[model samples]
Target chain A: MFPTPVEKRSRAAQITYQSLVPLALILWLLPLIAVALFSIRPGVDFANGNYWGVPSSFELFTNYGRVFFESDMPRYLWNSVLITVPTVIGAVALSCMTGFALGIYRFRGNLLIFFMFIAGNFVPFQILMVPVRDLTVDVGLYNTKMGLVLFHIAFQTGFCTLFMRNFIRALPYELIEAARVEGVKEWRIFWYIVLPLMKPAIAALSVLVFTFIWNDYFWAVVLTQGPDAQPVTAGITSFNSQFVAQYHLMSAGSIVAALPPVLMFFLMQRHFIAGLTLGAVK
Target chain B: MTLPTDPPTQTWLQRHRMIITPLMFLLPGVAFFAVYVISPILQSFYISTFEWTGLGSLSEQGEFIGMQNYRELMSDRNFEVSLWNNVKWLVLYLLAIPGGLFIALFLNQTVAGIRVYKSLFFFPFVISQVVVGLVFSWFYLPNVGLLNVVLGWFGSEVNILGNPDLATYGIIAAGLWPQTAYCMILYLTGLNAVDPEQIEAARLDGAKGVRMLWHVILPQLRPATFIAFVVTIIGALRSFDLISVMTNGGPFGSTRVLSFYMFEKALSEYGFRMGYGSAIAVILFLIMLIFISYFLWTMWRDERAARL
Candidate 1:
């Protein structure tokens, strides 16, 4: 609206605008396009110096199959699933109650507690790295899926609480007041009254958390080790080192590693964008 | 209401229910959050005063070498390089805001298949940074890369990532690809809510293009711009995944941002100097604290205003 819609402009101007859109998008996504091309490329193509050439043969199945069967990629993918699913559930579940409390009740230190969560969410990970790893190792949870899950759940609670609190605050208070007048217990009121209305928030947080934990490379490397516990993001880097010359295999693995989150984003596109743009607009 | 006199126990319970109920709900979340996030931050500060390999018991094996780690960080060349590199990152990462605004403005119009184009442009941000690094690494490969191939047409083939001086910039360029997309999406959302009446009013007043955008549009886009600035700064500072995937802070460690360098010092094969790593982490934490405080202050003011 600010720029004046192209439809209202002169015919020549509209033509110029239409032509630039695709060109701009193509350039923006060129890196990803190259990777997708490389993923489907035959191994022989890279050896023959056909990096930019049309693939001599489309080996999508073989490449993806090899990534699944011939490497530790399957294990890594399973690890990501194991870590991410529980984190989404745990973080969301915890934040629901915390958010309800902070949003609905006006207790002493309420704002202070809320700000604590917000502040903790933005602290650089390095501050928590050494001690978290130490604590994980000391608890004998290091190099384990549960360790990563616990850490992620706890860390993500900060952001999830911020989101859930704001959302709950925006919900109409009349329902809560009516429930209170009927002498319903607070917990039951939350369960029956607020929780049902929170389905959209829950969905949004679940998808966003799923993508975040799945794509987490730092904590995966720090809190876990090797195929036994490491998620695909970290595993792919190790894969890169092992198959240094096998760009096709590495590229295939990268695509596979990146698939779940991309799928989640596309599948839950609305919720994902809603969750991400939470504070972007007033 | 006093027809039946309540027992003291029941009356007391009823009186304190408000405070007790909220605390009960907050307990589990607060416990986990305190142990994992809050306590560790404090622990890091404590650990920064000691010397340890992080392999053994803290009290029995570690020495309380107060301020030694911080002093060493001052003289350490890698630390200096990482600090300077972080400054460079902070400066350059800001380019994403304007870049994204430009793209958002370009695509803000409704056209045939524009939704698909917008989503495709946003593809980079949804994927893992590891993939971004790998793709860019391949793109910067000296001879066979797309970049070199394009440059070769002009008779130039430069090894961008392999050169120490150019490696950081190359990686930053890769980072910007996704970062700019993120900012663009934020701005697009902001633009969607821009008041059409105000735009019409400005247009009728003979304001157009850059002048109109500068005077009318940017002020409305403040929230989006603020969020963009916050995330970009945080992303620039927490740049470990891409650096780890692309260079491992190599080409003679030219791209060692503080986060990666702390990991290298504390955990990686270089050595297990946990104390030194904590010191580095503390510095990064302090730098980030400044920004975090500003963000929280603004949010608090807004929250108070909303409540009132």
Candidate 2:
């Protein structure tokens, strides 16, 4: 609206705008398109430097089969799922209760607590690296999926609390007040009254958190030792190093590693964008 | 102002008892913050003073070295290089904003498959950075790479990733894929909320092209710009994955940023120097603190104004 709609522009200008769209999009997504092309090409074609040319043969299934059968990719994929699912459920559940409290109540040090969460959310992971690793070890959760989940849930709560609190704050306060006045009790006010209204926020956070924990490479390396527990993002890096000049297989592995989050984003693109742009427009 | 016909407001507040209500809500979040977030910060600050390598017996005895790590960093050329590269990254990473905005503006047109265009453009962000790194690495592959293939048409045979001068730029380009998508999404949301009447009024006043955008558009895009700026800075500073993937800060450590350097110092086969790594991390933390404080101050002002 601020730039003025294309329909209102001069005919020449509208024509220029329409012509540039595909060219720009092509340039923008060149990397992804190239990779997609590489994934389906036969290995012999990649070796001969005929990568961009038409694949001599489509060996998509064979390449994909090599990735799964020859590698510990299934285990890695399972580990990623094991880590991501728990982190999402734990982080969202914890933040819901915390967000509800911060939004609905006004007590001493409320602002202080809120500011602390905001500040914590921004700090680099390095600052927490040593302590968190040590704590995980002490608890006997190191090198396991549960360790990653616990840390992610604990850390993600900072951002989720901010999101949930801000969302709950924007809701009509009178609804909660009326429920409370009717002797519905504070807990029921949360369960029946407030919880039902947070569907959009919950959906948004779930998709965002799913992508985040799934793609987490840093913690995957630090906490876990090998393919037995490592997530696919970190697994792909190790696999790439081993495969070395096996470019076709490496491309196939990369695509496999990237599939889950891409699927989630496409399926829930709206909620994911909503969650990501939390404070962007506000 | 009309007075409430019911009992005074104090009675209602007393029944709720302001003291207990917020405390109940604040406790779990506060306790979690104290245990996981706040305490670790203090712990890291304390660990920075010691000479401990995370292995072996704690009783193996690491003498307390006060500020030795920071002093070593002062004389360390690699650390200096990494720090300078971080400065470069912070500056160059801002390109995502204008790049994203241009794409958003281009795609803002209503068309037959604009939705597909938006998603495909956003496809980069959905994939992991690891895959992004692999994709770009292939794109920059000397003779077989797409870039080389395209360049070969013009009779240019340059190795972009292997050349030290071009290596950092190549890695930064990979970083931009997701960063640009992120910024484009933010701008799209901001554009959605722009007041329509003002655009019509400006157009009627002979404001078209750059004048319309420069005056009427950019001011309303402030919120999105602020967020873009913050995320870009953080993304630049936090660029460990791509560097690790594309170059591994290699070819004589030309692409080493603070984050990767810290990792090398702490955990690489060259031996674990947790003390030195913590020092580098502390510096990164301080630099980030400047941006974080500015953001917090701005948000506080906005929140306060909203409350009024």
Candidate 3:
């Protein structure tokens, strides 16, 4: 609206605007588009210096099929699903109760506790690296999916609590008050009342957390070592090494590693953006 | 025991529910955060005070070498380079804000297929940074990639990632690809909620284009800008993924930020000096704390206003 909609402008301007949007989009995503193009080509194309030419033969399925059948790609993908799903459920579950308490109550240190989660949320992962890794090893959970999942759930709760608290704060307090007047038990009120109102937040946070945990490379590199537990984000490094300079297969592997989250973003664009913007300042 | 009409007595759980309920609800979340997040921060500080290889428990095997790691950091040349590169990253990464706003404004229209266009523009952000690094690494390939191809038309060629002087910038450019997309999405969402009435009022007063943007539009997009600032600052600091995937902090070790440097010291094949890594982490933490305090201050002010 601030730019003044194209419809309100001259016909030439409108036509220019329409063409410009796609042009800009093309330029913006050109790098990714190049990778997508590479994923479908034969490996020999690179051997002959055909880096940017039309593919001589399409090997889309063949290249992707090698990634699936001839490697540990599936195992890593499974590990990622195992790691991501539990973290989402655990973090969201914990935050719901935390958010409920922080949003509804006026207890001592409420703001302090709320700010602690927020501040923790912002702390660089480097600061926690040595200690967390040591802690994981000490518990003998190193190289295990459970250890990674535990750390992720704990770490993600910080942001999830912040998000969920803000959302729950926006819910009508009168609804809780009216329920209290009926002498409904407190936890029951949370279960039968507030949790139901939190469906959208849960959906948004779940998808956001899923994408985050899936794309997580640092912890996957640190806490887990082998393909047994490494997610695709980290495993793709070895995948690249195994097929070194085989750009066709490497591109396919990278695309496969990136696809789940891209799909999540596309499938849930509204909720994903809502989760991100957080509407913090205004 | 009294007559049937007598009121039921309040159980202790029911009577003290106000204090107890929130406490109960907060317990698990607070516990997890304290153990995994809060306690580790304090532990990092403690660990920074000792010399440990991280083979055994810190208290038993670690020697009390107070301030030694920090002293080493002061003299370490790699640390010096990393610190400077971090400064470069912090300054340049913010270009994404204006870059994103420009793209957002350009795309902020009701044209045909605009939704698909916007989503496609935001495509880079949804994927992992490793892939972004790979994409850009290939994009900057010496003679054959898109960047060199474009430059070839002008008869100039530079090996970007292979050059020590240019590698960090190349990686930062890779970083900006996604960071800009992130900021663009934020602004697009912010722009959607901008008050059209205020724009109509301004248009009557003859404020248009850049003048209108500076006066009316940007002020409304404050929240988006704040978020963009927060994420970009954090992203700039947490720039390990691209560095690891693309350069591995090489080209004469020119691209290491404190985060990557810390990891190299604490882990990797460099022999684990847990204390030294924690020391570097502590420094990064202190830098981050400055921004964290300012953000928390602003949010506190907002929360206070909302309370009344």
Candidate 4:
């Protein structure tokens, strides 16, 4: 709207703008396009030096089958789900109360506590790595998916609290005050009142936390060692090492590793953007 | 007087409800956060002063080398390179803001199926970085990579990823895919918020094209730009996956960043030097702290002023 719609521009300018869009998108996505192409390429081409040439046949199913049959990819996917779903539920649940307490209750250290969550959200993960790993080992949860999930729920609570607090603060206080005047207990006021109204925030955070934990390569590698506990992202890394230069197979594995989050994003695009653009417009 | 629909007698369970109810809702989450989140931060500070590998008992004998790891890192060349790569990443990664803005402007039109195109354009960000790195690695493969093939048509066959000089940039390019998409979304939201009245006012003043964009649109886009800047900076500094997947600080370790180097020192191919790694982590943490404090300070001041 700011640049004046295409019809407002000259015919030549309109054609140029239209033509540039696809060209730019193609150039922008060249890497993904190439991998998508390669994943379907026949395995025979691996020896023929035809890696870049157009595929002679599509064998994506066979390559995918090999990844499933020969690798621990399924286990990795399950681990990712195990870690991600709990973290999402845990983080969101914790943050909702934290957010409400910080946003609604004008108590001492409220801003300070809010800022703690904010600062905690930004701290480098490395600082947390050594000690977190040590603690996990000490608690006898080392190399277990539970170790990673417990850490994730906590770490993610920082950001999720930041988001939830801001969102809850933006909600009108009058509704809560009106309920309070009726002598409604604060807990019921939250549960029967505020909790149901927070669906949008919960939805946004779910999609966000899902993606963050799913694509979490750093923590996965650091906390978990092998197929027993490794998530898909780390699984893909091992797969890459084992299938080195087996481009088709690697491509197929990459696609599989990337599928769940990509599908989540597409399905929940609105919620994803809503969560991401939290303070962008303000 | 208002009449109650039910008997007003207090039940035995209702006496201390205020204290118990919130506690019941809050206990589990708070316990998880404390055990997993809050305590580890304190422990990291404590662990930074001593030596320990990731396995076995910490009491088994770690030399208490106070600040030696940090002191040693101060003189280490690899640490310096890693630090420099982080600086490079911080700078170049910001290109996503303008890159995204340009794409957002281009696609702001209401062409047929533009919604589909916008989603497709944003596809890169939705996928995991592991996949993006793998894709780009193929795109930059020595002979058969599509990038080299495209360059071949122009009579040049350069192996971007194989060259130590260009490998970091190659990975950075891959990183830009998602980063640019993120920025595009921010700008799209900003564009939606731009006041039509101001643009109509500017158009009446004969402002158009670059002049309009510079004078009218950009100022309105300030909030989005700031968010874009913050996310881009944080994302750049936090870059680990793409580098790990694409180059692994390879071709003579030209692509090492502080984060990756910290992981390498703490865990992977390099031996587990937990104390040394924590020391490096401290340095990275301190660097990030500078930005974090600045962001918090600015936001704090803004929030306070807004309340006034």
Provide all candidates' interface root-mean-square deviations. Answer: 1.9, 2.1, 2.6, 2.6
Residue A84, candidate 3: alpha-carbon lDDT: 98
Q: What is the lDDT of residue A179 in candidate 4?
A: 84
Better of 2 and 4 by lDDT: 4
B244 in model 4: Cα distance from truth in Å?
Answer: 1.4
Docking model 2 quality class: medium
lDDT of 4 by residue, A77-134 (tens): 9999999999899899999988877777665567887787788888888888887887
Candidate 3: count of backbone clashes, pairs at least 3 residues apart or interchain: 0
lDDT of 2 by residue, A78-188 (tens): 999999999999889888888988888876767777777888888887777777777778888889988888888888999999999999998999998776566566777
User: How does model 3 score on DockQ?
Assistant: 0.65
The C-alpha lDDT values of all candidates are: 0.91, 0.84, 0.93, 0.85
Give Cα distance to truth, residue B292, candidate 3, Å. Answer: 0.3
Q: Considering TM-score, which of the candidate structures 1 and 4 is the better prediction for this target? A: 1
Off by over 4 Å in 2: A8-16, B1-18, B56-60
Error of 1 at A207 (Å): 1.0
Candidate 4 whole-model C-alpha lDDT, 0 to 1: 0.85
Residue-wise lDDT of candidate 4 within B23-119, one digit each (tens)? 5555665576666666766777667788878667666667778888878998999999899989989999999999999988988878777777888
TM-scores of all predicted structures? 0.97, 0.95, 0.98, 0.94
The model with the greater DockQ, 3 or 4, is: 3
For model 4, the stretches where C-alpha displacement exceeds 4 angstroms are B1-31
Flag the better candidate by DockQ, 2 or 4: 2
